[model samples]
Target: MNSNNEGKMDVLNNIDDQFKELLELIEKEKVSSFSMKHFDRLKKKRKTSKKKWFIIGFLILTLISMYFILLNEQLTYNIYFVFLSFVRLILIKKCVNTTEIIKQSNITFFNFTKSIYLNHLPVIIDDATDSWPAMKELTLKKLFQLFIEDPVLAENDLCYFETNIRNYNQAEGADRLFNDYINGKRRSFIGQWNNCKRETLKVIRSYYNKPYFLPPSVTQTLMGNWFLVSAGFHKGTDYLHRIPLNYDWVWLAQIQGSSLIELRPKHPCETICSILKSVTLNKGDLSNDCFFLAKESYWTR
Candidate 1:
């Protein structure tokens, strides 16, 4: 009995010692893991801090280089004068007479060919868009629906937007515009969406008839569709502005809201022909129902 008891005591002592060693091993392993994790975090933070400093240093160097270059060339003086000239032009306000744009109502296609086109003057045809179904059928909601169906059209991501009416530099996507306009998420001004596919143009053309004023000799070298969506006022601010001159003739069909259209001749024509014409176009019956036919010779808004 004594021999058996001694053997059992030895076995119990060995098990307890093994368990203690196992716990010590586990504690050492946990401490090692914690140290490794702490070291990794410190390394990442240092890398991020280094990257930020590098970017700041690069930008400072670029600006200093640009300043020295500008100083050497005396280009800064030229830039200042150009800016001063623009400011001077804006400050000078003259109460000059603005001529009313020429309007021809109920005119036959022959008269349009002779008077407007031959003379190369911008005119408002009050009855030109009378037969266009788009004047009746097209709405803001319908315009969004037209392009939203095709998965391919949604990929048209490079859309021009006017953040401020005076500046047309912002760019966004048509899909974003559709979403913003429909969901009432954001207020935006949409500009030209050019280079439309033939299938897309065909769909849009079905809503509107071609102008009868277009001469039979006129050939369409390029077909384009521009969707201009705006609330007339952006963020409750108003500024006088003009559309940049497009070197081609443009027929603007105002399907919905009223816009004040102003036409002025090119800079060179300012001396000889100082004619500035302004007109208001509203969509309705024959009298107010009008659209603008802008010639290449004028800058219009």
Candidate 2:
């Protein structure tokens, strides 16, 4: 009976030793897995650092090459001009294609709005103002006669009178002689008149009828509270101002005279100090008058 008890105790001790060995093996495997994860993370970090260094090195090399190429006196200016010319040609081609599409497609006001909204591109519609009574009656002579007859319209507070026809520099407190200015220098003036004012509304109603191509639905969405009448005497005069950045769209109708318009793309990363494209509009050419619809993301001159 004593020998049987001793054999049972020995079996129990062997089973305890085997369980401790299995626990130690599990601990070693946990440590190995942790180390492998740490090594993988380090390897990934090293690869990212190498990629950044390679990009930096490539940029430096490119700058050095450009510097050497520009150092040559004869090729420097010529190369710069050549590159500019190439860019200009590409822009001109784009303008020509756009113009051709408009001419060929017979784009109406509805389609024009759709195209601009969907593509966010600028468009020029010719002969848009042919039906306007202002096109036929609002010559420089007739405008002066109308203003002379009505002092209120001529000297309204909202009217902007400029001595320099070329720019917006106002003639500091200069006497506004309507007849003299119109007859003499024929300088341009912009009058703020809309349908809200009874007196001006009468005048606007006579000549500035709603465009036939514009649907009533589109008219409802337009910012119609303010309407400006811009009259200029000189040929090259322009009103240059940046459109408010918040505005998504703008339309300019040329009432009279010829104009040269230049436009450039606005980019967040770059300053646009140059014009990308320039187009000249002449009287009764292309269209009797033109309407330019532009996305506010474009800078116009």
Candidate 3:
């Protein structure tokens, strides 16, 4: 009877063990469910935050736009008063008005000249990255000052310099910034004039730097004496006509602080690499085989 009781006790312990295992399993499942629910809720919150921010931004933009419309009405009225004041001043300031009148006439004439001469020039060719803008590219008025202040440039060269700078502003894709930059003139028109001045300076520099090419005796004789020059023509054979390359080219250009100097092209996109390989400049030469073959067509511009 004692042995039978011991066996019955063992069986009871085994049953208890099974029950405990089942409880542990159930607890684990419950924990997993809670974690899953938390993950789902967190995902929802992230989605909601993104949408909420978007809505807030949209509302802010709408309010700002409305404010501008209201402001524009006042601005338009102010412009009319300002214009009227200008007209009265023009009528009264005869000397001031006369200078302005002549300036306007000159501008109109310059525009006409650009329409004829730079007809082939793309409007989108923006200004060069000139570091010394004031001294180098931004010095057209200085040209007028030169004749007034220092030596004089030949009439023909002087004319081209003036016109080129004027037309440089006409470069395509630069209308807005051009107008914003110029002051003491119509915001829109004046900026274009300033841009034109800068562009003209770049073109003038490129023209003068034609390799081994010198101007007429008068120009050579009067180097610094001449302020500007017309780029007549460059050797077509020196460079390939076209270089077919898949490249976003950013040229290393020089800017001066009241100075100008000649530099050679460092990157030879096509055949120029081969031609300039032998012609090294300042220890940097655009001489590479694959590059030269690529630009194997017309080289001169």
Candidate 4:
């Protein structure tokens, strides 16, 4: 009986040592970077419409003829003369109007491209740490990528977005008017996510304009199944500010523990869930399943 008891004790000691080794491994290797989705949407250029000189030349001629010849026509006297006069007047307007339109479009496009380029983050190896300014640019980039990709999954990520957004197939400079509208409101909406996600191409980088925050409204709009990210026992303060991200109701997993764990819902939707899905929670203070996994890592004692 003594020998049996001693053998069991040795087995238990070995098990404890193994557990410690496993814990050490988790501490060293748990950090992850986002590499699952190979985003290439940004590579495809949204072709810009070029200036149509033919239209401009035609407009010039129309205005010249209208100003010199049609201006003196008797008012509403001959139907043909009246029509020519109207055509010339319209041509002049088109020429002047397209000028502003083209300029605004180019500006809006420039800002729009910048906003998209900064969204994808090269996933970092140490995932558990982040500060507002420390992760500012990286956060902005990752959020932008996520913003575009989510839209693609929903199908609205491919349309061109702008002030007077012309149909993608249009040639008569329809984009002119659209570009004008967007630039006119640049600071308020150009590198915007909520307004553009629904109308943009998938994962085209629409979230980096502001580094500290991702749009909560986008997540709030989701209606299907989702995973809820919890901060576990850690109540939010500045570090958990990312929790309020607006996503749809998701499934929940509760974590509990002492402290030191710095991960939580990066948005409100990351926390707000419709149902309690599954939990990787353990018997300690700091823990996370930031990744969706069945098996969990946590303290037993």
Q: Number of the top candidate by TM-score?
A: 1
The pairs that clash in candidate 1 are none
* C-alpha local distance difference test of each model: 0.52, 0.46, 0.30, 0.28
Query: Which candidate has the top score in lDDT?
Result: 1
Q: Show model 4 residue runs off by greater than 4 Å.
A: 1-155, 158-185, 189-301
Q: Write the per-residue lDDT of candidate 2 for residues 86-120, one digit (tens) a residue.
A: 54434432332233213212456667544532333
User: What lDDT score goes with residue 55 in model 4?
Assistant: 71
TM-score of 2: 0.44
All candidates in order of TM-score, best leading: 1, 2, 3, 4
Candidate 1: lDDT over CA atoms? 0.52
> Candidate 2's error at 274, in angstroms?
9.6
lDDT of 3 by residue, 1-301 (tens): 9999999999999999989999999999999999999999999999999999999999999989866744564343344334533443333322221110011111232452233112211111112231223324333333333333332211222312122234443434232222323332322111111212333334334322211111111111111111211122322122212222222111111121121112222232221211222221111111111111110001111
Worst 10 residues of 2 by lDDT: 291-300
Off by over 4 Å in 3: 74-301
Better of 2 and 4 by lDDT: 2
lDDT of 1 by residue, 185-222 (tens): 65455344453465555556666655665543343322
Candidate 4 local distance difference test against the native: 0.28
Candidate 2: C-alpha lDDT: 0.46
Q: Candidate 2: list runs displaced more than 4 Å.
A: 1-106, 165-177, 185-202, 220-247, 265-276, 284-301
TM-score of each: 0.51, 0.44, 0.24, 0.14
